[model samples]
Target: MMFQLQIARIATAPLPVWIIWGLGLVTALLLFLSVLLHELGHSLVALHEGVKVRSITLCLFGGIAQTERDCPTAMASLRVAAAGPLVSLILSGLLLGFFPTTKSIHPLLGNLFGQLGALNLVLALFNLLPGLPLDGGLIIKALVWKITGSQRRGIQVANTTGRILSLTSIFAGIWLFLRGGGLSSLWLVMLGCFGLGATRNQSQILALQQVLRDLQVADAVNRRFRVLEDDQPLRRLSQIRLSSTADQRPANWVLVCRAGRWIGYLDDQPLRDLPVQQWDCQVVANHVRSLDELSCISDRAPLWQAVRALEHAHDGRLLVKNAAGIPCGTLDRCDLGEAVLHKLGVALPETFLAASRRQNAYPFGLALSQVVDSMTATDLTEDSV
Candidate 1:
């Protein structure tokens, strides 16, 4: 273990290692720096458009610039999204111009500069492709959004186009592999698969954006989570869980109430970690994800609004309150994602199916109805703290 730790330290050392490093370490560093610069362009433009740039990440394929808020207008989005590619194109031009002068310095330097120029050009042009998860896709999405005034429709169009192109690339990769193009062909296959997987989520996003805009949080509120007093014993809660139906996705967290006031939740982990003898003495309030730590949204609010609320929330789960200012339900992140996939014609995972089968004996596999029926609610007091 100590040797492994030392090796990790050596590998992650701040200073670059010459020659010994693989993947053309110096070249890779230059590429990464260039990508970072490109992302900075997008960030600066997003700021100009009044959108807060949250983070810029450079990954294996390229980079992504995430903003705290989505652009309010298609024109604003177009400019922000186009900035990165424009930066790359500029860098490409500069490198190409300097490559000739570098030949007098050293052949190695000239070759390196030439390759950097080529890579930048390729980066700019590749991102111009009309597909999802690409700058070109964003450009197309913004244009379509502007014309139709429906972001969902724009996403659907890009998703469909990306699917066709990704499938074509996959076949092309396979052909190259068969012709002994070898490792490079394998890379193409991998890139195609990555693109395919990434774009698959677009369909769900489109469906969600459509449905959420029309529906309210009240329609999909989950009230099945049990509320427990903060003074309650861990053993008692554990017993309840062990005695309950053998649902694999059984509620792992319990809502905690302190003197009739709603706190956040009591995760079951501490219960299992604590000694059995101390279980009764250790009150839930001692370890809870506090109510103040979570965010609340109106149950009457649209589902898309709740989605936005979750994005701003730290824990990704919101305490859904009714008009009376009573915490009526919990809106979980996973639940929202599941709703989107369901709307996109994706079936629930097998774990959910198995859980439902054991939770209800309803005929015709309508256990979901029984699950809904089983959600018993206890009215919250005025001082539910």
Candidate 2:
């Protein structure tokens, strides 16, 4: 009986499976190929506008064409942004036009062409919505930028509009769900959420870029920091306490030194775990991460460079050194948060200010207070002292 069932399955599966699989693979390939063509349209336009094309990538949803650098002008950006949608629209028109002719050839091929045409049309129209991270949003941004002469102002307007549109879509999705749309409504809601997130994220990225523009990491540096001898007797560590001076806030990091050189750093977490009795028996060198394992950035480097380092680093706090190869200070996301807020001209909220001042709760010192005024716990990590 099992053999009979298996034989039945094999006979039934071969024809339909092969045909469906072949058709499906061809359809998917064509869709991605169309996406690649759309991205190429953008890349070609970018090249025409004197912007260098880095690469064109076909993604699950669509495609992305990256430029080596931002377009030099608003008009240029607008042209580049519009190019992909224009290509999709053009492809849709061609497919629809040719679909009628394909009907005589084969039913499967005809249906496939019809579907592709419809999808391309939808893709073009959907992407035309004025939301950030979308082609239409870039067009809107370019238009706004051209009129206002400020790229930041353009991003603000486009992102605000995008958020509003996303909310509308979300509400519409909820309405659809109430009307028993089921999976379709859920899909709409997901798209709305994705759009909303993308818009906000792109806006924040623009803001961060502008705020950190031409700014070096040195501007946020606090010259007053503490260093410890790695070979020093651990019993003396109890005497070392954070000092709040008028000139500087407080030292966040205690750099470990060996032979008069900064070799590593003592982690405050492990030290706090030990009893007072064991302090004398342990050496400071044994409790610290070696310099080789530490992430270091130059004081002269840009704030963005430090940010990139911190993003990929195991520790949030970086060992910042001066041109003289001496440890000047530590750079953390907190400092960046403070600087970003200062750059954006936003006043620190009272509640946030109060929380950052709680030194005992966090790893670092009072300098963190300045940043806590502007940044949240998500922006900075409490991995170091």
Candidate 3:
């Protein structure tokens, strides 16, 4: 509807309704295409720097390019961040320059070119404002990273600046609204809110990442597993279950051994499949999985490594091993979250922990996978430098 009104205003003379609507549709598509091109510029530069582009998504706010990993150096990050705005600026220049030539051919074409060019210019300039989640913020992050030689410190600076800017923008929008600036002012408020929300989330994630870096996988391990002989009859499972209690519950996972050496694991499916009558005849040997099939993590590794490994695992679980390379226990997203909260001196109730475990999610609904990936990438970059 806004596009329709804008198109009607742009039309110098009365035209067919169909033609007006068609022009509006074309204009909208072209504007979005410009945004896509801008994001593409960033993706291409990142690719050239050996970063894999995961996806490019165009949204109502704008477009974003997600990379598989961070750039390995400050210079590479700067280049990747600047490419989008640079593309926008170039497009603006080309369109604005071509508008005059179109004016002599057709008035509508001239208006379209003029508006598009001006919009692109605004897009470029607006995104150049220094704040997190924006191209300019990334540039600032790169500069700080280069100067301090620490990506975490760079993120802290950028995020703090972004939060300040977001608050200022929100207030400015409210002032404008109070002064009768209307819907335009509302857009400003919305943008500011979005920025504030994004920055705050990033801040939390940063804090979590720092906690993970300071801790080890052993801190999050739950010794709720049992080691069973591969040759044991399936009836042993029923006995273990009957002997378990609330405080002394049996392991959810049962590791298998053959000839006193670790072999595989007993999956839950077979336990559910065999009835009481067949349990005595069935053996754990045939139902055991190979050791190589499990996702394993070392207790000596930092917690962030376990987070990343679990995020990529099919079951969202890890078999944890001690410093001696012997599997000691298991860790899941909930267990890891408990460790993090415990480190922060925050205690959760048993009910919340139980719910999180059932849902197979982190406590308090925290999302740590992406944060781990990002922080780990930054560590790699710092190590290389």
Candidate 4:
């Protein structure tokens, strides 16, 4: 994840000696407090929902309460989301009650408080917009989930609504921009763009999930593969890859060949740290591991289950074998992602998958599964696919 800091936080910094420090300090403090309170709304609700509050970030975009886990139900999600805006609304109301009109206090303090109160009110209202990745969208998602009895379906509905809302917001922002609405209009356009990007990510995730639901390792596994031998040097194995044709890349493990029969697999970690120049000289057989140390599953296992295994093991790939203990094929995280993308009808080039595999990209298998499940549910419902 990218590191982010709240724009409201900058005010906490000491001002330059030459500037009007008092005014800057006062404005900064007020903005910080308001943003913090708004985020607290979300944190408190999430805590109530049995979700861990990771952090509350009060950035330029306002407050974001990061949670350790997603709420269990739509209602829980809604409540957690609604908490922040509700807090903001309550704060705004309190401010209003304290000063019916910002008429009596010093101009600076009064204006600051009034602005903070109004911003909170706006925050509450804006978050109530029923499009995804937003508080309002979460509410809609929860409602849809309640009605549909599927969280994935709710996400699809919410995401579709989010796209529609985002597009409309973009068009309106554009119109405002053309009509001389200034910087605020520009900000609106940017926000719409952000919404669009988030929607795309959600759509991709859903697609992958659907594919996982439909696929089984049995369908994709190649039954013929070599396993690492225990006695061979890492350098010798590296040479085999160097001499292979276009179809073969260096297998991470070579089959332990004993009397021309497969016995066990070898560990490849020792070879990983060796210098290229020493490739053919070192023995790798001593570094080999028995079959029990590795997690192997039959080819007929569901792709989702396999993915979960791969994730838990923290390995780049899993070895697929048949019921007879014969090495069948391997499932790399990248292969799963590519397969998911293919099912989604996304036209990613084969080279991208290959490159990503070589680079060892992070596993998004679980995310893909979730997305596919959501899309499948949505498609069945005819309301939002």
TM-scores of the candidates are 0.59, 0.60, 0.81, 0.72
Q: Model 4: runs farther than 4 Å from truth?
A: 1-21, 105-108, 180-184, 227-252, 256-262, 266-289, 311-315, 323-326, 346-385
Error of 3 at 211 (Å): 1.3
Which digits, one per residue and each the tens of the lDDT, describe model 3 over residues 125-204? Answer: 88888889998889998999999888777787888888888998999999999999997998778889989998998888
lDDT of 1 by residue, 60-140 (tens): 546888776657778988998899899999999999899889856765566667778888898888888778889888888
Cα lDDT of model 4 by residue, 1-385, tens digit: 0001222333346445434455556556766787787788888888887888878777643667877667777788878778877887998887766553553654434555665677678778877887877888888888888888777788889899999988988999999999999878987788889899989987866665656657788754543345555566677666655665654333555657666566666545655777776656766655556665666777887666666666655455677888887677777667666665656665567676556666555233235434434433334212333
Off by over 4 Å in 2: 1-15, 210-219, 225-385
Q: Which rank order by lDDT, best down to worst?
A: 3, 2, 1, 4
- Per-residue C-alpha lDDT of model 2 across residues 1-385, encoded as one tens digit per residue: 2222333443424445455566667777788888888888899999998877777777756677866666777898899899999999999999989887885676555667777887788888887898877888889989998888766567677888889889889999999999999877877788889989988776555555645544678876654356788877676555565344332233456678888877777656666898878888888888877666667788888666666676666756677788987778776665655566666666566456335433222222323332322222112121111
Better of 1 and 3 by TM-score: 3
Q: Supply the TM-score for candidate 3.
A: 0.81
**Looking at candidate 2, what is the lDDT of residue 154?**
70
TM-score preference between candidates 2 and 3, better one: 3
Locate the minimum summed-lDDT window of 10 residues in model 3: 376-385
